[model samples]
Target: MPKLTKYQRRITWSTGIGFILERMDAMFMSLALASIIITLHISKAQGGLLPAITAIGSIFGGIGFGALADRYGRVKTLCWTIIIYAIGTAGMGLTNSFWMLCLFRIIIGVGNSGEYGIAITMLSEAFSKKYLGRLSAAAGVCGQVGSIVASLLSAFILPRFGWHVLFFIGIIPVVLAWFIRFHLPESKEFTENRDAIEKDPNRDFSHWTELFATPAECFLTIRIMIMFMIHIAGYNGLISWLPSIAQERMNISVAGSSLWMIATIIGMSLGIMCFGIVQDHLGSRLAYGIWLLAAAASVFLLIIAQNKLEFLIGGGIVGFCSDGMYSGYGTIVSKLYPTEIRATANNTIMSIAKSVGSFSTVLIGFLMDHFSLMAVILFLSGIYLVSFVIMLSIKELKHENKAPVTTTENAEKVAQ
Candidate 1:
């Protein structure tokens, strides 16, 4: 591997920090949902909408900001996304009504969506292809770390200071944005693409139709998007409902559930790191398929675990396999597209998947209300089986010989 320049190092560090902050803010609400519901005197069903709202915002934010990133530049778009999420998070503290809080969360979602794609793109662009998998995995691990921190804060801080304080504390990420804006340079990939466009007098900037111009490109896009949808649906939908599942099915306390979740997050962090290493060595598609299959098996085993210890062990395994593959999605997408439409492609495909997954959350909640927790887990696991098939059937891009690397292609590669 070639030595990374100082600029590349800074971009990676900044992008990882930005990704962590984005994930932390996004998850803080999930950890604190009970507190928010209690403080506002809202029903449990209404409380569920918080994530749905964020998902909805993410659907829009991912596509809109992703396209904007491709057009305006990744660094500039990232700056705006960070600022938006920071203000929205802090604003969560000020809102008293449930509806108002939802509005703030939606705004936060918009920022959260954009932040993810741009940061992933930025980091991927800065690092070499050999390091892309591990770097992207590291970025995801940082996000999981942020979630773990939020979990710890929820466990310790919320009981004494109230949930509002969490949002107020989220303001710290916004402060980090200044450092990002001044310190992080435009990705080398982005600069090259910009220069190419400048040099070409006939280049059209008015529209972006090349993203779906080819059948193979369109097929790959659809397959990946479907994979994301099923992955998120099973992962997010199941995890989001795990607390309630633990409380009702396992007869565990909220604190116990939180600890169990902490264990899962730790497992997820390890899984992501392991997946990255495997992707770098074995390849993304194979690594992803193996993880998904393991995850599916884990979920099925989890459903049959009779005791708390057994359940926790199963959950951890599921976390390791299921959530671990998320980092690979960004890396794969970055490799699949060119720099000019990289963010747009990443955001659009992910957003569509997220939208489907978000809607599935509602369905999962309905299923849980009618069926047992085990039943829901089984259902989600079945969905992962479909994802496994999709993944297995798709063409593995990494195996192709001397793939054409355009300016846009390089930009997408850098951002991965």
Candidate 2:
């Protein structure tokens, strides 16, 4: 591979860090769930609602920030999102009531989802199609690094100082916001479009309607949303419960759960890198087909394991298969949409899917209370097959030029 230019390198690192922070928030919430339940004296079902609430906030943030990014600028929107995430995360440390916790989680959700969409959209615009898959996957690998860090902190802090300190640690990502503000420039593609719209009064750039302007477009958007919903459901169903399952089933300590988490994160990083390479060489269809099936089979390992060694290795395989395909969502959305609505398309579909998926945490928690761990694992595994089938039907977008093809051409290509 050729070396990246200074700007490419900057965008890569900045977006990678953005993903890191996002993943860190998720991992912290998962790892800290047990402690939060005890501290707040909440039931498992209610505890599950916290992340769901955050997902609800993301729905608003994703749509709102996406429109703002298309209207204003990706970098400017991204900086504010990060600051919002930092503030929301910090506020969690001070809250003792469940409602207050819910409020803060919403803030974190909004910022987290916004940051995710803008960062991916910016990175997609910054690079060519040649490097899109791999660079996006690289940022995903960075997200795993964040998960690893959160796991370590969970092991060290949750047992020592408590979960409040964990929320305080979230405030640290604000430093990343500072660096992004000073160093990054706006995406050239976005800037060009903005200038064109400014120059031509006749050009109508209002984009939200274009998403559903026609039957075909609306159907395609729904198809993408369902696939992503399945993706999010499968992921959250397995990961959100893993730590708790290890503790309950295997009698693992908080620190030991961290070890399991680290092992899983290592697998996730390797899998994401490998998926990017595979998707680049092979088409997205074949690549997703393989990983989705692997995810279906691997999730069973979590339920059947009898020992720590089995669980540890099984967790890694599960992580590899399950989350390896996560970053591809961004790449796919960015490819399918034009510059004007790319951010909106990316955030709207993903956040809505996440909203649906996030609630699965609540459902899974309720299921675990009533059903067996095996039941939940079966649900997670079955959804992957559903996603795999969906992947086969949906066409991959392939654009050869920096300027994407016209909507007519895009539709024709998609049909082919």
Candidate 3:
């Protein structure tokens, strides 16, 4: 991999920090949920709706702002997204009513949704293809770090300052908005593409239609969407219930569960780092195949564990294999689509898949109610297996060196 230019480093940090803020806000909301429910006198169902509202906001924000990024400029749109989410988060602190808080959550979700797709698009334009994977993964690792920080911050602040303070802390990232606006440059590839489009009177680019303009593009998008669905399903299904499972089945204490989370999260971080290296050097297919298979196998470790130590180790392996490949999806779509619709492709596909995948928690609960814990684990393992097969069947493309958006011929060139 080549050394990064100063601007590349800035983009990387901004992207990474953006992810960190996203994760931190998510964690704070999760940790403060119990307090928010009691203070607002809302039922469990209404409290649950808060996150759901956020998810709905994310779906809309991902598509809407993504199109805006393609039309406007990446850095300019990114700054707006940051400000939107920051203001929404801080608004959550001031709201006294349940409906008001719900509205703010929607705003927060919408703002958070654009960061990943836009940042990934920007990075794709800024960095060398050779270094893209690791850099993306590094940013993801930063997100995991953000979760850890939020957890620690919640532990300290929730006791002293109350849940509202958590939302207030989110406003701190607004300062990052200023730094990004002034320091970061627009992607040269996107700028050039915009110029070319402007110069040609006959040219038409619709972010949504560009994704499915041809049969090949449609199929490619569908296949990628399925892969994303599987990825999110496997993650949400398993991790959502892992702690409860460990507590119920293994008789682990709350402290033990926390340790298990730390272990698993560390494993996830290390796995993401390794994925970056492996995918960058060895190619995405081999890296994904290996991780998916490992994920499928590792879940069984949870089924067989006899002690807390074994369960913790199993959780770590599961985290490593199942969640580590998260960043690679951005790298994949970035290569397949042209710059004009790249953010849309990334956000639209992911938000739709994520919206679908969010049901996995419910599905897992249904499965657990009807069947054994082992059965639920088996189901998750099967999701990984299906993902592996889908991954293998997709035609691989050679890495493009210069073009922001790949031409069909370049996009279709099979990897040797």
Best by lDDT: 2
Score candidate 3 by TM-score against the native: 0.86
Better of 1 and 2 by TM-score: 2
- Structural similarity to truth (TM-score) of each candidate: 0.91, 0.95, 0.86
Rate residue 349 of model 2 by lDDT.
85
Worst 10 residues of 3 by lDDT: 400-409
- Per-residue error for 318 in candidate 3, Å, reads 1.4
What value does the lDDT take at residue 265 in candidate 3?
73
> Which numbered prediction scores highest in TM-score against the true structure?
2
Regions of model 3 farther than 4 Å from truth = 30-52, 94-102, 158-162, 181-183, 243-259, 365-372, 397-416
Global lDDT of model 2: 0.83
Candidate 3 per-residue lDDT over residues 1-416, each given as its tens digit: 66778888788888888878866775666556656767888754565456556766778888888888888888888888887787798899997889888789888878888877888888888987778889889998998888677767766677678888877886776676557656577878988988987897766454665667678777778888898888877875655566557757888643345445667777888899999899888888888989999988988998888888888888888889988998898988887677778888888888777667756656666676678888888888898899888888777544433354543433545332
Please provide the root mean square deviation of candidate 2 (C-alpha atoms, Å).
2.7
lDDT to native, each model: 0.76, 0.83, 0.77
Q: Rank the candidates by TM-score, best first.
A: 2, 1, 3
Clashing pairs in 3: 338-405
**Candidate 2 lDDT, 231-336, residue by residue in tens:** 8887776667789999989999988887789999999999999998887777577778899999999999987789999999999999899999988888777877
